[model samples]
Target: MLRFIMQFVIILATLAAGNALSSVFHLPIPGSILGMFLLLLGLLTGVVKLRWVEGVANSHLRHMTLLFIPPVVGLLLNWGAVHIQLWKVLLVLSLSSLCILLGTGYSVELYEKRKRRRNG
Candidate 1:
């Protein structure tokens, strides 16, 4: 219980720091995004141990879909505005998804080839 509380406090502190940075710089991006980037940097630099927050993060991930419900409902309720640019939105989404798929496929193939070369 104490560990969970400590991890939660650490996450909140990181978020608060990110919020402060966004507000100070008048950044267009949200504080949560900044906090996420900060957390990523910490992990990559080995400043933050994954074990410290992994449990809580995974618990949140299990209910991740629930988090999208509010935004989805809001979008549905304001469908009039969304419908006006529906085609444009669909076009962007389709193109982006296609790009992501192709990019991921190419990346995986390259990784596999490199691994095979190293092993052989």
Candidate 2:
């Protein structure tokens, strides 16, 4: 219990610090993203030992699905607004997914070609 509390506090503190920087600098990017970068930097630099945070992090991961409840609820509630234009939304989603799939495939092919050149 003590370890869980400490790890949770450490994660929240990092998030708060990131939010503070975002507010102070008026950066266009969101604060949570900043906090992620901060956490990554700390981990990479060995300033934050993974053991210190792993407990709480694992707990959050275990219950990650619960996090989507609010957004899913919102979408259901707003179904009427979206239902009118559902066809348009489906078209956009389909086209974008195809584009993304093709782009990812091309990227992987290029990466493999470069890797082969380097290795051989």
Candidate 3:
């Protein structure tokens, strides 16, 4: 319980700091994204150890679907908006999924071939 609360506070503080920095610099990107980038940098630099908040963050992230349920339900309540963009959305989704699948498959194949060459 304490861990969860601490994680939530840390996330909020990071976001607030990111927002402050963005406002100070007049950056065009969103505060949350900037915060995420900052968090990533901190992790890479060992300034923020993964074990420090990994458990809490992972737990929250694992149940992130629950957080989206209300928004999804609200969207369903306004089904007309979805209908208007259905075709365009579907086309984009299909194309993006195809690209991801192809890229992942090619990457795995390349990795396997390289591994085999190294071993042989």
Q: In candidate 1, which residue pairs clash?
A: none
Candidate 2 lDDT tens digits, 1-120? 988999999999999989999999999878888998999999999999999998899889999999999999998999877645778889999999999999999999999999999999
Off by over 4 Å in 3: 81-85, 103-120
State the C-alpha lDDT per candidate.
Answer: 0.93, 0.93, 0.87
Worst 10 residues of 1 by lDDT: 79-88
Candidates by TM-score, descending order: 2, 3, 1
Candidate 2: regions farther than 4 A off: 81-84, 114-119
lDDT of 3 by residue, 21-101 (tens): 899999999888899988888899998878777887888889989998999899889887665667898999999999999
**In model 3, where is the ten-residue run with the lowest total lDDT?**
78-87
RMSD of each: 3.8, 1.9, 3.2
TM-score of 1: 0.66
lDDT of 1 at 115: 100
User: Model 2 Cα displacement at 36 (Å)?
Assistant: 0.8
Measured on C-alpha atoms, candidate 2 has an lDDT of 0.93
What is the clash count for each candidate, in the order shown?
0, 0, 0
TM-score (C-alpha) between model 2 and the true structure = 0.87
**Model 1 lDDT tens row, 1-120:** 899888888899899999999999999999999999999999999999999989888888899999999999998999878646768889999999999999999999999999999999
